[model samples]
Target: MAESDAWILTTGLNNGVSKLVGEGISQYRLLRRHPKDVVCIGLTMWGTINEKTRIDLKKASQIGASDEACKRQIRDDVQEDKETLDPHHTHCILFDSGNLNEYLSDSQRSSFVQYVCDDKNSHACKEVFFDNMNFQQRLIEL
Candidate 1:
């Protein structure tokens, strides 16, 4: 793959889909002995429990502020928190979905798709929707 090529894996760090893909990427890299050539990016929604906790603690001093104020502060602070990536991942992308069930907007989806598939050489990419597939089926498909 060219330096511009990348593999975008959309899933949360703690979720089953992410684990499966991370493992697969690791194994494939090991087999080829060229880990640096494969860029595995994990994309996930912000505001997970783990993420909130870390952000809260980091901004503990501001907890006493008004609810709305605290919320705004947390939002601003979390935006700068770049350590959310899973250890096994090569890179990370976080989307600002207010709630867990919120789907990406049409433009967001299009931009993300373009980013992953933009490479001229056509690197392979897979998107696994956890709600649409059972764990066993996802593993087999991947």
Candidate 2:
């Protein structure tokens, strides 16, 4: 329960606050407020990703089928479910595992990759994760 330690969970993050609570920890305060006995996700802001990939390869009459349509249908279903459940959680969305690559340009991506690479063995990723907190604290300086 060190101030710098957290119990992290790996989920799609699309499930939103309910899933966060259902999995354990009633709130996102684990990221702060009450840092002890925290519950956190390694990848956040992934609601869009969860909506994009799913598999429901079952034919109308057949039990098993391998078709693009089936996969798309399943993906859509997953998206619907995730969309319905997302929201209600207020927390900084920590990006990891190339999740934010789409928003970054090639140069920015390279810079971030290098930054993270510099801390590959340490928990330096958390600094970026909580960068907003730093920004907020500096609002007066602006």
Q: Highest lDDT, which number?
A: 1
List candidate 1 stretches off by more than 4 Å: 1-6, 34-36, 52-85, 98-107, 115-142
For model 2 the local lDDT of residue 116 reads: 47
Clashes of 2: 0
RMSD of 2: 13.7
Q: What are the candidates' C-alpha RMSDs?
A: 9.5, 13.7
Model 1 residue pairs with clashes:
none
Best by TM-score: 1
Q: What's the TM-score of each model vs. the native?
A: 0.46, 0.26
Model 1 worst lDDT window (10 residues) = 133-142
In candidate 2, which residue ranges exceed 4 Å CA deviation? 1-4, 12-23, 27-39, 42-81, 84-117, 120-142
